[model samples]
Target chain A: MNLYGVRAIYKFEMARMRRTIMQSVLAPVITTSLYFVVFGSAIGSRMGAIENISYGAYIIPGLVMLSLLMQSISNASFGIYMPKFSGTIYEVLSAPVSYAEIVLGYVGAAATKSVILGVIILITARFFVDYHVLHPFWMLSFLVLTAVTFSLFGFIIGIWADGFEKLQIVPMMVVTPLVFLGGTFYSIDMLPQVWQTISLFNPVVYLISGFRWAFYGVSDVHVGISVGMTVVFLAACMATVWWIFKTGYRLRS
Target chain B: MQPDISVKHLNKVYGGGFQALKDVNLEIYPGEIFALLGPNGAGKTTLISIICGIVNKTDGEIRAAGHNIVTDYRSAREAIGLVPQELHTDAFERVWDAVSFSRGLFGKPPKPSHIEKVLKDLSLWDKRNNRIMSLSGGMKRRVMIAKALSHEPRILFLDEPTAGVDVELRRDMWEMVRKLRENGTTIILTTHYIEEAEEMADRIGVIREGEIILVEEKNQLMSKLGKKELRLQLQNPLDKVPGELTLEPVELSEDGYELIYTFDAQEQQAGVARLLRTLGELDIEYRDLQTRESSLEEIFVGLVHE
Candidate 1:
């Protein structure tokens, strides 16, 4: 793998981002701000606190996940989809860029957007309410890990999608629903034992819980379990991406 | 001269049992333009796609500059560049960026000078900074060609490069192709425009029904398979062919003003002399006579249908 090839893909990917900064960067910020207002202030004012931390601060992790998930899925999926829709994939397909390079370029770009959006939401949340970070390392680690993991997952979604409708189905129907039901608004412990057990199966619950733990040093889920869940999901997503590249699935055939 | 491409018994069948190509064998020599002539769905694209490694071949072997296209795609692909028929480009990207990125895809380092030369050659120097979407259709097509040539490939494949292009651009592209050939690039072109192949191709291959029907030097193929027609204008019109005239190789014109006779020029016994003698014996007077030679398009259509 030549660095130049990777650089070319990275540059192209960013170029795509620049083309729709309003949607990529600005839209997420606005959406996250709304989340902070609606969920953070409107609901948190009456809900009070969770685990000694204010509800306003408690929901920060879930908010970040919301933005990260959307950004990762949209950025990566559209990044690949636009090329295909415009018939420009042949440019990449015919080029000497290997499958690995293509995946790295796209996923890397998606992660870049996810991180930027995450940081923006984190910073924006401060205006609404000041939150104390219990461990800076854990917070940063979770942010980076979540961004990379979801970006890889998004890359797979992009490959699997054949059209714009297909692209929207996974994120809108599957990912969005999972994130919402995974306890982004409230902890699963508040549910019945059966529902709580079912909620535990949702991969995103651990991501949000792990992130919540980082923000206020407390969560309904154990930190170790959350971290372990994220690692497992990340590994599974990476493996899926690797398999897609190795088999030349939609990229070639 | 050594052949730049050698394809033997190539075959490709898509997942739905669609056989795009079948037993395609061809040898494109270095520094010559070979035109693959065919109608739509005639396997022109499949043949070139297989050679370029964009589509997998179900069976057969293809070597580009002696490198197997499947086993050794990198070097072989590096040796060739393809100008796809579609006008696809990064709409938001600058022309210069697109060209340079294509070059980098081949693992080549950033070379501003090389980029500058490619842009200048395609008359895109002024539009280097402009977004690709802003360019006209002709300009975008040129950019596609520029990108293909950015790597300085030894063999260039133009799949219907002139389709939908205006006359001026078509002429300009032909001139550019000629210059590239002069620079020693082996060019393979597939086109429906017989005039383009007639004017540009050193050798021509007619393909149809997923098979290569004939491959021969342009002039040789034309002469070998060409037919000539003679139309004799009659002083008096007849609605039906005379019994005596029907015995020879002749048909009366629908307008009843002329007799049409077809003959192969390459054949030793064409019966043209005997037909003319018979016409004279019948005292069939004609005002004038005209002869038409088969053009490449006619020969191509004939061979493909045959």
Candidate 2:
């Protein structure tokens, strides 16, 4: 109900992104662009087509997903964590804002930033490869959904972390490795039969697969299953956030 | 008139099983400066935090501006602004944006003129465009005050507003506080400085061991509990109090060179007259006599120790 409060927080967070444009927006965009140059141009030239699509075009969606997942988590986590660390969180908590509004403001802004970064990376990728979006609507939908879900996940990490080191632990140790092993540069279909079966268990595989399907209408898993898994994860993150606010966990004493 | 804030049977037990607040009750009248005096862990911050909706109470009810802080959180919180003890702000943010954003957080529409006035009042108008990190310590504290007043709430809670502040800023802050009171804002401040309470508080409340030991009008508490001391420079040294003066609250100085008489200030006339008459009749000569009224600091120490 407190739309003004939500807008204020959203604007404040977005402004922070502007202030740290090089770190927040430009770094990821440039890094993903380099991935296109290295992986798409250099490595793809030596590989055969994937699912009847050129190798360079094939990795575009995956590259964008890599950046999206990382950016979403890092942005959201750092957004909330900085406030906690600096103690300005008391200002927000003491205001008239509701818990839902606070989440919407922070997570929404984080997702917005990630989604913008994803789109920019996609544009940058276009210069290196000839990719087509078989379903542009679905591509956009998947982009937003992934950003929001991961941002929510990041929000949880931000709250659960008590120190700066803990903040980077999940993104650096768990998420980055998962994204790399989730077929960002290669298809799970190319893996050994047993490894492919095991790759199905890696959650990032579903996201990348579903996102790639939006680009070329082909995926390692059923697109429907990928979307369903994402929705399930989204619901779980929402439930966890609800519990955090209800119990005043970490946010209050 | 109904109190601006009413706390009933409040209790706060931390997750670690440390009881931070006992069954405490207090009512603060509207438009009055009330000072909560206590040491570091006396639960002054806890009580303010619970009322501000920042900390959850283990058991109790608090109503601000007639809204229950728990059930009607938004409304209750809208009526209150808190200047916390910690000096924390968005280091990257400009003063203008920080104060303006705080107002917006309370769901108030942006009013540039009002923000300008608040900035001017706090002597921060010139630094409105400056990043908070670039400001000095006193300037940052003023920025905090500006942010608290941005929403123009009816009630303001200043938790150690003058702690670590320079004397000049402290004086300015006190003057600003009085100006706010004139504007009809109810102010509740917690402080380690008893002189601050003595100077500004219309009513003073002392908290000790998570309980409110006393709350009374500042003048009344001073007069009731405040003792007057009479010091006599004796012509002759004495090892003990004279037997005739034993019934009075009298004691001999450790050096045995002076006689000290302690009495309630309310009975100043009769008590001093009788003491002087007794001294005259006993032939107890004194080269000098001095009378001193007990300060709020002494009274506070006495109550806390008791």
Candidate 3:
């Protein structure tokens, strides 16, 4: 099983995180704090509740989702990419470890980091506004599932990217826009019928809706549909990762 | 006794249709230092990479420490440690952590005492807490060795171990190689530095253009191809060889001030005495004479050129 090898990779990544605490942990925490200050306190104080939930509390799950997605992708991608960049990947490839262990180590650590960040942000929301976990178990489950799924997706991005700019392109250009347009701030219900129908096409919509449902018990989409959508995306990422390792794409010659 | 490492019918063809190795067959016994010598693009690195399980081979069989490299990769890989030709390191990592990490990567349980001993042996104990990026090039090379040794593999492949290092570092590395061999570790090193092979290898294998042309005991290869040259400085110039010598006129150098005779080093005594007697019989007086032995470098050059 090469469990020691897996633990080595996991510890190495966690050490890297600790070494760059400011960039890894504090930066997102501070950035999300600003969102709390501006959107949750200042703007939401004037805005009315959208569906029996205060506007301040309504945005908590959405904001947590935004940070979770970005952080997970970056952590996992950068984790795998650094070895290739520094030419130390040969050590990992030559070790007595399986591809599954490799993925588990990198993705597991990345997911753990994002989940921790998600929890910290949720705690920070307590100071900004009041919110409750209508289903705490479901909330934690969604947090972990989303983190693991996105981290796997990020691992693929790391393998596919040839340059540093490519690493940033997808996360910034594709993900941020989808999260914004997928109703991170406002409900899609406020949009026209055609716009709401189009919103369903954005995968982030289901993720946010299911996560929001775990918090407020009210969601733009049914919780089961959102869960099903997230599971499908997770499986797709898993298949892609499996294929990448099987073919030795960008990893071996 | 069984071989410590063996490769049979190894062939590697890259995706672009470039064949890097062809029908390579080799066996390295336990507790021996075998040097693979070749020029650039001769598949030295590729051969080592495949045997270490880093690069996949198109066709072949390889066994390390009694385990097949592909079918039972985990144990095979665990039996070997590779110090690549290039100095690749995790720059931000501390020496202590990086060495321990390598040990763990081989599925070994944490053995701080072993890690400490490896670091101390490599003279890296004092720098254990320092980041790798802060070290000098030689120290980085040392750290690479430390990492490779941290796992205590039965076989070690040092690809160009002393390349691009200073004279002192090269000497230290040579000494270390001897010490490791004395410890009963089978070491396979690939290098173009003929002197390194001449100085370190118990057996030498020469690879040229993706093919292993020769492998022999160091002394045997030297004796088989070794040549000695004798040169004489004549007191007077000769337009030709005087046409009176028993040997051909090819022995005379241009301008005719000196004569050179190349012979087998092992039987040089008899040949040189007879040649000098003939020269005296011809009344060819010489002011000075010198003998030179061909180095391994010349033999290597000749083999590669052929």
Candidate 4:
């Protein structure tokens, strides 16, 4: 209801992103570009195509998803965590703003940043590899949906984490390993029969598979199921955030 | 006029079963400075936090500016400006942006001239463009005050506004508080320094063991509880107080060189005159007499101990 309050928080967070442009925007772009050079060019030359698509172009969507997921979570988590750490959260909590507005402001800005990074990585990919968007509308939709879902997850993580070390634990120990194992570089069909079954259980696989489908119309899982799983995760994160605010968990005492 | 803030039967019990506040009741009048005096862990901060809607109360009903704090939190919160005890600000933010943003958080439209006035009043106009991290400690505290005032709320809660501040800033803060009061803002502050309470508070409340032990007008509390002492130097040593002087609460110094009389300041004329008359009738000789009135600090210490 308070649009000005939301705008103020959103602008402040976006300004922080602008202030730390190198770390926030450039680092992810450069890191993903290196993935293209090493995995797309060096390794793809040896391996043949999958589904008649060039190996270099096959990994573009996966690489963009990798960066998008990490950046979304990191941006949203750090945005909320810094306020908690510095005790400025008291100001926001005591103000006239509602919990919904606070979440929207922070998560919206974080998703905006992630989507921008995703698009930039996609453009950067065009220079190194040949790729096409079979469904441009679905590609944009998946990009936005993934960014928003992961950003919500990061918001919960920010509230749940009590220390800086805990903030990095999830992104480092869990998310990064899952991204690598989710067929970012190769198809899951190449794995052993049993390993392929286990890869289906990894949630990141659905995200990458669906995003890759948007790019070249080839996927390890049906695109409909991937979209359904993303929506389910988004709803779950939304429910968790609602519970956190309702119980004043880690926010009030 | 109705009280600006009214709290009744307020109680707060933490998760570990530690009761931070117990059956507390208070009513703060509009346009007056009320000082909540308590030692560390006495729940001063808890009380303020609850009224501001930051902490959830275990059980209580509180109304701020005629709105229930729980049921109508938005309107109640909009009427209050809280300068918390901790000095926390966005380190990378410029002073102007921080203050403007705070105003917007209260759903107030941008008033650049008003922001400029507040900054000038706090002497932070020159540093408006500087990052908060680059300012001095005193200046940062001022910025906190500036942020609190940005929305121009009807009531202001300054929790230990002068803690860790130097003498100059302390004086400036007091002056600013007075100016705000003149402009019709009710102020409530908590402090460990009795001197601060004495210097500014129109009324005083002392909290101990999670309960408000006393609340009274500053002058009335002083006259009612404050005691005065009269010390008389004897020209010659005496072994004991004379029989006539025994009716008064008089004591002979251990060395038998002086007599000390303690009496309420409110009854100073009658009690001291009677004591002097008794001394004259007894032919007691004294070289000199000195009188001292107990300060608010002494009264506060006595009340807390009691």
Candidate 5:
């Protein structure tokens, strides 16, 4: 099954993360911490609690989701794209490993990185806001599922993109905007009735909602529906990645 | 004995409909150094890439070590390694780590001893910890070969292994190629240097415009197509040929100071003896006679031009 190949790619990617620790691990953690400083401490002091929870604590799930979705996509996209860019992809393609093993190695490492960062942000949140997970297992599950799903999606994007600018277009243009509008700092309920209805279409909303339910048992959308939506999205991403490899789209010629 | 690598009726037409390789059939014997010689855009790299599984073939079959390249790719690919033409490598990776990564990627268990041996063999042991970018061009080329060898494959494809390197490094690389062949690794290399092929290859294949026009043993090809020329320095100048040379035709120099006779390589002794007898009968006196044999470069150029 070329398990050694999978481990090679996984360990190679993990090594790259360690090499770029300042950008990969530290930068995201610092960004999340600043969100705490500005949005949690300074801003939450003026805003009243919504849904009987402190404003500082309520945003924890949303912030974690923000970093998770962003970091997962970026880490994974860059991880695969760099090989295509540097022409090292030839080695992987020509190796004895199958496409499945390649994906397992790359996406696994990226997802693992995102999960670690997500947890670090949670721990860092303790210094500023006293947050508690209403369901720890569910929280961890959601974190992992979201990271894996997004990493797969990022893998597709990495294969699709031919230019460095194309790599940034989806993450910056589509993902960041969705996360911001997905109720990262405020619930969709706080918006007008029409805006709240429109927010349901944003896929990130379901992820954040499911994650928020795991945190405080309060969410804009039902937990079951949120989980269902995430699973559907995950399936869609898996299919896309499978198709990319099967057709050798942008990979083999 | 069975072939280590067999390619039959292989064809490749890229996305834009430009055919890179025609219906090519080749069989590389186990433990032999086979060199593919071709001009630029002659499908040398494309052919290598297809066999290595980097480029998909449009049609035909390829097998490595009795395993089909596509249907039974794991076994097929596990038996082969490729060093591409370009110097493409992970610049940020240390030499040892990068080579080890290749071994693992090919599904082999980690072997530090094997990695160490490859490093020392390439004379890169001292630079194992240094980043690839820090190495000289020759060392980087060695690193590429090291990576290809990391998996200990039975078949190795070296595409232009000595391109852009200095003469001394080229010699070293050729020596390494010979050493690998001695270890029973079947090697198929694409190269522009015909002399290198003449020096090392057991057989040579000439590709032109996506087609392999000729493939034969190096010595056989030379003997069959080789042209031999003999020149005579006249003791005195003459205006034109005396026309008494009936067995063969001879060309007179413009100044009438020398005579040139071209003959088949296989009839070297007979052809030369007949020419000299005719010259003596014609009373053409010469001070010195010299023979020159056509090199592989000339033969290659002639084939490509034709």
Candidate 6:
């Protein structure tokens, strides 16, 4: 809980982030912009609006979600994996820095990257297609929550992963597919009744839906349910992360 | 005052029932250099890992500066510093950043002058700004020491600190370790080089097959267990030993030109003077003679063989 320990870890992680700014910070900004161009302008211009919103406006939440998901996973996973790979984990474990301090430092760094990217996409979306936030506070709330929750999930992934290839498995195979199928570009309502019901089980559906609700004051799923699911996930992920740190799972083992 | 470090009945059994340590007991006193020597896979690294809290012991009690390593880890860990055998560090981090960051890990307030003194003592001040990956192997080793000493721990464990190092660097490191001890830090070193123990250890412990074969003060261990030899040079090449020489414990050289008689110097009657008289009675011609004293290496080899 000491801020000094947190600051030490934070500075170490940010230094790593700074070392690869092109990969961590800038790459996401550029990738999200491309999504705006191709999906928002080229694709959205031809297709009509969904739920009375423009095609450009419809994909903004999804794009933000995409960046947030990838960056959070990448940041946290790399943060933990690199230390293991480079053998610096020994130094950190031997230090007076507590497990909680280590987690906070890494998760905080991941959140920093994801949140910054989320904000950049939000600002960029304004240029492509003008949109008004029905509830700016809700928008900010979901943005911060999604960033923190996913970062924690990524932190868990980092702890669980043994090799570089394993680091990518969760985010690439699991998180990416969940984000794409969660109705980022299209609505689950457009599908048949059974498929829509099945899509309801994907946890990412709630995150995107909740963010969308924050934007236009309307969403496919109930806003309360989406928010509730996010809260549940945040708790689950934080608990799992804390347990890993407490048990010294892969770290001390 | 309590011992600087202590381990009682320490044991570790790996997953396939491979016992790495069995009923090991050891203590390191304050301001003394204790060397742990053993062949590979003899549990030197495992013992160190458990003491440093890097590896879990199957059953044991370990305390550093009166703090149990398992229950009171923070204080125990804070009381000691470890330099692992591997040269692992954040490759991208600058040398200064790496050392300073390691200090911060101990929750110590930043002190610029103390860090400067550490870097200077290790002769690493010039390379402080260089990235760790760019440093040479010897330089990297110094950085490891710098990082370990940054937190100002009372006890330091150096696991094979001189492996793969040149003689000069090895000597320099030994000197630095002595200086650290002079300043009131207890040092525990594990080395493959027996000479390091011979030259530096106040006490030595030898382990083999996950068991501590022997532990004793260096000079006492040598005198108590060390064997000495008298090498007799023949005045003329002997085709065979005289029948009277059979009564004595001696080894004939392959060429049959010299006789090697080994005996415990600590024994009351070494029989060396009698052997020479017998040689003279047999009219054995001798041109020269020399004495060979057993070294710690020979003692270590002897114990491990046992």
lDDT of each: 0.86, 0.93, 0.92, 0.94, 0.93, 0.88
Residue pairs whose backbone atoms clash in candidate 5: none
What digit string (tens of lDDT, one per residue) describes model 6 on residues B1-306? Answer: 578999999999986799999999998899999999999999999999888887778998999988998888888888889999999988889999989888877778789899999999999999999999999999999999999999899999999999999999999999999999999999999999999999999999998989988889999999888888989887677777778988989778888889989998576554888898898898887888888779999989988988
DockQ of each: 0.54, 0.89, 0.87, 0.83, 0.93, 0.67
Error of 6 at B135 (Å): 1.2
Instruction: Give the winner by DockQ: 3 or 5.
Output: 5
Q: How far is candidate 2 from the true structure (C-alpha RMSD, Å)?
A: 1.4
State which candidate has the highest TM-score: 5
What is candidate 5's lDDT per residue for A5-70, written digit by digit as tens? Answer: 999999999999999999998999999999998889999978999898889999999999989998
Model 6 clash pairs are B235-B285, B235-B286
Pick by DockQ: 4 or 6, better one: 4
Report lDDT (Cα) of residue A46, candidate 2: 88
What TM-score results for chain B in every one of the models? 0.92, 0.97, 0.96, 0.96, 0.98, 0.96
Tens-place lDDT per residue, model 3, B170-268, is 999899899999999999998878899999999999999999999999888887888888899999987776665646323888889998888876663
Mark the regions of model 2 whose C-alpha exceeds 4 Å error after superposition: B234-241, B254-257
Which lDDT tens digits does candidate 2 get at residues A75-186?
8999999999999999988988888999999999999999999999998888988889999999999999999999999999999999999989999999998889898778
What tier of docking accuracy does candidate 1 attain? medium
Tens digit of per-residue lDDT, candidate 6, span A1-253: 4566678788888888889989887888788888889988988899988989998899899889989988888898888888888887887777666777878888998888788888987888888887878889999889888888888888888888888899899989998999999989998999999989999999999989989999897787999999899999999998898788767788875
The interface RMSD value for candidate 6 stands at: 1.5
Candidates 4 and 5: which is better by TM-score? 5
**Which window of 10 residues has the lowest lDDT sum in candidate 1 chain B?**
B265-274
TM-score of candidate 4 chain B vs. the reference: 0.96
Encode model 5's per-residue lDDT on B1-306: one tens digit a residue: 999989999999999999999999999999999999999999999998988889999999999999999999999999998999988899999999999999999999999999999999889999999999999988999999999999999999999999998999889888988999999999999888888999999999999999999999999999888989999999999887776764576888999999888887866478788778877887778999999989999999999999
Q: Which candidate is the best by DockQ?
A: 5
DockQ-derived CAPRI band for the predicted complex in model 2: high
